[model samples]
Target chain A: MKSFGSIRRNFAPWKDPAAKPYIEFRNVTKIFGDFTAVDNLSLNIYEREFFALLGASGCGKSTLLRMLAGFEEPTSGAILLDGQDLRGIPPYRRPVNMMFQSYALFPHMTVEANIAFGLKQDGMPKPDIEARVKEMLKLVRLEQFAKRKPHQLSGGQRQRVALARSVAKRPKVLLLDEPLGALDKKLREATQFELMDLQQDLGLTFVVVTHDQEEAMTMADRIAIMDKGQVMQVATPAEVYEAPSSRFVADFVGNVNMLEGEVASRDENRVVITGASGAQITVEHSGDVQPGTHVAFAIRPEKIKVSSKQPVGTGANAMQGEVWDLAYLGDMTVYHIKLDDGQVVKASSLNSARIHDDPLTWSDRAWISFTPDAGVVLTR
Target chain B: MQGKLSRFNIVSLVFGFAFLYLPIVLLVIYSFNASRLVTVWGGFSTRWYVSLFSNQQLIDAAWVTFRIAVISATVATVLGTMAALALTRYTRFRGRFLFSGMVFAPLVMPEVITGLSLLLLFVAIGLDRGMFTVTLAHVTFSMCFVAVVVQSRLLSFDRSLEEAAMDLGATPTRTFFHVTLPVIMPAIVSGWMLAFTLSLDDLVIASFTSGPGATTLPMRIYSQVRLGVTPEINAVCTLLIAFVTVGVLTAAIVNKRRDLQRQRDEHAALRG
Candidate 1:
């Protein structure tokens, strides 16, 4: 079996100065009445990049996608596609297609007609339209159900038909808005991998907008975490997970334990923080901050180690606490420990063995320890 | 207790149907009576039908009514569909409330008041009262009914389908014709049928609007009824009822077949 983790992924087009961006949103600002949907946002997307706009609801991620799809025009600024201005062009004239969140299949038409609709709109020859429709049906594994209406098909099948119809004309870019949102959990998981593989196979630039953080993490090569119509951070999934630039990004993407602290002192290579609990935490790296400046120390729950005994290690930061709560998940165990000063911190460990030799219960005295490099410091 | 409830339900069903259909059934049966006296029982005969065919005045009135119904229904359908689209799609336009009010007000307006107002308007305008005037009145009233029907169906329409069509490179006009029209076709057809039947059955508006040489079937039948009830009138009524029944049954069967086919296809897909 092949393991994706063992292989290094190459994402170099974004860093190459000579490569021109395929799509550019230059200072795009969209306003509906008095509400600012997308604030002066500028972004660059390269060709064949699977980019995801990740945000909570009403965070303007979908507004950005709609602007690209030409359903909406920015109140100010311009969008450029292949170095040409995309202003004043309607959605039908654009070289991009979108799969709607509702699937939006024509209830009156059969699947074959729905997929062929775009090709017919393009004034393609009849023979070519037929062949292309057949090919799209095969691509989505829906060849046997071409005569069925959208209502007759299952949700997953209808989703595939929407996908095929959106891609029937082989658009330069495919924009998906909450693509698997209507499917069951098991089907959604399967479709996520299938979508990733499809994007890779077609080498098409895909811009997906989703509120699901895990879906964005699983499928996108690069993700832009958005909040209040602004990009907080844009990086690879691993970078966003390991080195989030802000406390919001850290908290949005996954679970994290935040320790409020003030910088006690700064050395040439390391900074010592005095937590609100009065525990001294020494970090290996120092930020450009003055001494006594307030900051937040964040660490993932998986990175913290919990032991019943006073742990002996390579000078790791340790906190004394009692187990306040414990949840025994089938694959992992989460322990919430409360310090003497009444601060709760969470730590999780994988259940590698079928049976544990020892288990920590509620009210058990424990020590939570982590290395200096396991946590990140955020000023915002 | 269940048996008693079921018996009560059966009784009510029978009573309801009898109350509704008994008069029409009697009228149809009496149309075929051989005797001239309506109250007398007579053997079944086709003499009334033959007399109806030979009655040139009644036939002329029927012909005029048919023409008005056909012309008015077509024009009403077009105008009503446009009104429905405007009201639903242009949500933020000025005077929308007034427009919707006018569209719906005629549905509940007293027919005598509507007829009197229309008659006064025609006289004020100095337009000749004839078939043209009757058709205009019919169109005016029937258009409202068609608009109400189409509007109800349009309210439940999925607007995203039109967006999808446009997203798939179809122009707005093409999207309406190819997607919107086909999906809402059932409502439009039923609306047209309603307008047609309403026009055919109208008496007061036609009477208020008609001039010489434009007497409709109902006007002629009313004059004859004022004098005396005739078997010929019954025969004509039976014919009209037959036409309406055929139209309604065809529509119902077509809708049923479509629904059944959809259900079957869904079942097959589930099994697969």
Candidate 2:
């Protein structure tokens, strides 16, 4: 498995002050009748960046993508593409293309004709259109099925034709709505990488909307987690996963054990928190915090260590508990340990060995421990 | 078990088909009778068919009916398809409910009332009634049936296909011509065929709207039948039945072939 971080190393244009945003949404809000689908939200996407809008259904991600595609207009704000206002421009006039979730290929046309449709719309020469169509067919690896109609092809083939047709015109931006959502698991996983590679090869700014977090994490350079038509946090996959900004983000992205507590003591580099269950958790932190402030310490299951015996050095970060449940997932085992104070803490350990020498079973007394930097202290 | 039908099912199927086709079979078999009377068959002969061809008045009426059916069906198909598109696409326009209700009103309205109202309107407008008036009346009533057929198709139409066309830089007009029209063509064709058949067989509306020298086949046959029952009438009826049966069978075959092609394509897609 190829790591996503290594594919686009040192690509942080958002952090650079001089790098002007290629696409800017300035306080865009869209309301349909009595329902507000997209609230007043602003976001900036750089050129050639694979940006993803990640959320559950009806979180305004699709609305934002539609606004960019010119299928919809923002009610009260402006959308700028390459320093030009996109307001009042019809979808046909805009230099943006979208691949619909339904893979809306013209059913009457062959694959070649479907790909040639946009090029012909621009009144490109007939020869040029044919050449472009041929190139797109080759690009998406559908050259052999160029003459087949959409109904004659498989689902994945139809998806590729839709992609080819949308990108054949070389639009300034390509918007994809739930691009890989219809494929089965193995195909979806394979297509995610293909889409990323295609985006990089074309160097077109790609903004994808998907509710699948794994898809967003695998293909997007940056993801914006949205809830109730508002963005909760915007960061890379690692940042959003490792250091979520809120309780919702931590819980929404993946499974996490949230320990509700209040700050017990604070220092320059670390803070100790006393949980509601009377368990103390010490975490590494640098932000200024006052004592007795309420907070939640969020930790992923894989970060904590579970064993039958107590560890030697850990004091405040360790707690004695009984093994409540365990699930063996082939690659790792998750242990749910119930503390004496009636709080269940989940811990997962990698199955690196073929045979376990001493595995903690159900109802066994155990101790769960974590390092100071393993968990994030969320104040909200 | 799967291939064999039960005795009760076989009996029901036989009774259903016999109930529908027995009268038509009797009419068809008697068309070849040599006797002048339609009910009594003296012997087999082609005399009635030969005389039927020489009947100039009947020939002229048939020609007039054919012309009216062709012209009215074509015009109604165009106007009705446009109406269906407007109703289905622009769902929230002003007076939408009223417009849709009016479009569908003719489907359930009494044919006599429609003919009477159209006759009154033509008379009030001081327009002479003839083949022109009959064609106009046919277009008015038959367009609603076309609209109904096309509307149901438009209802199930995937709107994203149009959006995809627009997204690909085609104008709305171009999208309709290139995508929407081609996709709904089957429905439009069936609607036109329906309108043509309805106009060809109409007698009451034609009677109310037509003037002298504009007699249709049904009116001619009705007048001839009132004078006497002739074997010639049975021949003409059989010919009409054969024409309509050929048309309906051709349409069914075309639809069945398209469906089979699509199923084969899907099977190939799955295998590939």
Candidate 3:
């Protein structure tokens, strides 16, 4: 989260009422035979924004991206690009480009030719095409490898070529399907920043589809989490992580300990929850939830603390538990505590000191505690 | 332990190769015989080769066979590529199972049955049998082979390549020409060569489908063999073998050179 530079541009056009959407899907639904790949969905993407469609496979994220790319038409709605309807316009006529997951560089052509293909198809002048191709190669730092074929390059190099080729025409929008799904972990992390920088430099809207939550969180300004052909939630990474709207969104984005509970009492400032295991919980957020309504309390593992002795904070809610398991991860130690009510909760503490002083061990009597504002109440 | 050739393996290899090639070797040797007798070789002379040029009937049959092979192979390649595309690209079309069955039926159906059925079909349609009929028959059978070869290639083709082309502002037709076709060219080339060789060497199907004045090289050679084994026939067979060998060798050499050039380019890229 450290600032890499002082120039942080405000890319949140979604918050601006007067700002028009660069791409919009209005009540789009795509069906294949009898299966609905994308249900009735409406979404808006702003210009020059890094948007991510994040979901598991078969969750309709890829189908939504393909609809925007004009590869698949919605059986029931319209897609607009820059205020123009994108119906009956084939993919070739659409002002969008896609970098395929496989990095489908033409095997029969050299890197230069593959980058020049779209320009040649547009009947650009020969000199202009050459200049553009060279410029793209330079942008990807692959100027020396222009004459080589795709197979001759490494995986990261091939990916760069695909990026360069897809952006050579400077389309209004760029679609990337699992852009880094094929790379190794370390390389994928590095390429994520590179792709973000490239998108910024080109000032082109990028709609990336990925199943990896970390990838979406790192690269996208906003992510639309999808499930079962419908959008589950759309928000900034921090917003989704902090205030997930549903139990599904909370569990899918990160690790969470869920406690089925019923609302004991509700007020403007706080709500008391009675866990099924008889553990009383409290949340700070006030909602219209009625007393005695069934709900689930979702708390992230890192927000809870497990101590060998009873904690001394009066505002904190504490429960008696025994450590069931402990894992010492170099930077943090995770302890799985089983409460006396037969409920298990995970708590992690940062290992800031070099030496462990009176560390909690296996089967040790411990106190697990969190404040009223550390968890979210999920009604659905 | 895995790759060492045992004595038994060596013996079997030698025996298998000799069994397969001894007859062709003998034929080739006798094609250069000076004497008229087929078995008794007077000396190594080019007499049979010299007489082969003067045989007008053999020359005419050779010309007919060449024309039929060229026409049929060309037609078969086009039709087979279409069939492969249909089978691979259109996965959910109606009657897909029946279409695939029909495409593959000619491959395993007895050649005699196929030839007889085709002959009857032509007669029922009142089409005069000639070089055109022979070519039609060749096309019918060889197209299936081409389809099988090209279909396997298409099965392995990365479909995303086509999508990439379209995403880059190329229409479907242009994508096929610039991306799919060039990538599948090797398979198509081999399929066409196979069709040509099959048409060139066919005897039973051609005899059943051909009419008067459309005698192919196989038909002419069969008739002469029935009469007697002449050194002139051996000479013609030797020349046919030479032509096929040269063609196959040239193709292999060209393909190898392309591979080598690509490898060298890769090395240069890595080094620089």
Candidate 4:
């Protein structure tokens, strides 16, 4: 089995305490009239990191990004880019570029002109600007589409042009607001990997704001889940998925079976709880918690095992249930097991074989079981 | 159902077009008459048209009117586009509402009242009433029309394009010139055309503001019409109508060709 530390081998600057942050937001708060868009938020982003701010709409992720790009000023506190305060700098003078969600390519300019716009603004020599534009076009793999206007290009091609235009100047940091939000599903999936490779190739710090959790999980080195103008959690994808800090993070990231319970007993690394539905739940937790404290035991569906016959020698983590529903996905089968106490538990098993000789069907008596280390105990 | 036109529809169509164009058609046909009288058509001839070219007074008036229209339209387009940019880009400022109300007030005011007010203001300022004052008065009223035309286009403009330009390291002034100006060029051109047409045939305002030397075409035509109508006057009016028709047709053809090109580009993009 692959462990958490092994998955991310060397590129973890955030883990080193001595490493200085490339960008820092210090107690920033932005209030528009009565509505507070960002409320006393602080964050640190490392150099060359592909960071994602993931949240639902109106969660202030875009506002945070705009603030970093110098389009917005924080009502209080300061933002520092490489130790320099970015409070009064205009967007034109800032060494950061943004790829807008609308992919705001100049409709009047051809593809080559659009990509050359930024380099020309810096007053580069004519030959240098032409060479840089050619390099950008080749980087985005649009060699034959230099003369096409934005309207003459396809949506995906326009997206690439927008990307190439923003990065042609090679800013210190690139801010992407919903970069893949405009692409279709298949195209978005393909572009996600391309963006990852490009980020590695350019070696620039990237800050992406997206509402899609799957996109964040696929591309970000670290994901910051935001809610109501506050950062709920910031961690690597594996840590966020396997060990969410709260019930909100657990439910927001993926599907989880959260059993509401109170702590009945505790040991060094194991905590047993009596659920509200009268089922005994045991999970591995090293945190300090008193007995009788209410908590939630969160487990993902794929962590639990469902079988027709009850497994032998299983204790508090095993429960008898009936198969209430099942979904036969091409690569896996998900069973919704209704326990005897009327709580529905979801368990997914991979469909490794082509056919099942004795498959558990609807209303069939089944057993759902998991080990103590499979789930986490959330205090909030 | 598609090819057949009902009798009621055909009758209404004929009546609508006739109501709009019958007088103009009569004027055009009478311009070609060999008779000196406009109402009597004594067969077709180009004699009146030939005589129109030699009428030095009418030619001078036409020249003055053309100069005023071109100068006033160009000035109004520049000022009105600036006003539109200010109104749309800055949504909140002290007295923004009052400023916008004053800018659009001339649009709804009666032309006679506007002309009278402009005449009073020019006289009060000790400014001579001549080609300059007349151009100034036309610009005052026609620029409001230009503002309204450009304001509607600015409201629907995507502001992110400007922001993108700024983010790409261009200054605000450069962004406006390179991005905003080009994107809004069509609206600005149309606004200029509208102002030009408004200034071209204006009679009341021009009469109020013109001095002894600057007699415009509309003022001359109105004075000549008081006497017996002549085929020479009809010929002049016909030429004016032909100029306007050609202008309108060229604009329409240009717009249609642009739209067709856009459609073809979109189709090619879709196929790819």
Evaluate all candidate structures by whole-model CA lDDT and list the values in order: 0.91, 0.92, 0.92, 0.93
**Model 1 spans > 4 angstroms off:** A1-8, B1-15
Cα shift from native, residue A284, model 3 (Å): 0.9
**What lDDT score goes with residue A353 in model 3?**
91
Q: lDDT for model 2, on a 0 to 1 scale?
A: 0.92
Q: Which residue pairs in candidate 3 have backbone atoms (N, alpha carbon, C) closer than 3 angstroms, thus clashing?
A: none
Name the 10 consecutive residues with the lowest summed lDDT in model 2 chain A: A1-10
Q: Pairs clashing in candidate 4?
A: none
Q: Which order, best to worst by DockQ?
A: 4, 2, 1, 3
Worst-scoring 10-residue span by lDDT in model 3 chain B: B263-272
lDDT of 1 at A283: 79
lDDT of 1 by residue, A69-172 (tens): 88899999999999999999999999999999999999989999999999999999999999999999999999999988888898889999999999999999
Ranked by TM-score from best down, the candidates are 4, 2, 1, 3
DockQ of each: 0.72, 0.86, 0.63, 0.88
lDDT for B24 (candidate 4): 93
Looking at model 1 chain B, report the run of 10 residues with the lowest lDDT sum: B1-10
Top candidate, metric DockQ: 4
Please provide the root mean square deviation of candidate 2 (C-alpha atoms, Å). 2.1
- The per-candidate TM-score of the B chain, in the order shown, comes to 0.95, 0.96, 0.97, 0.98
Clashes of 2: 0
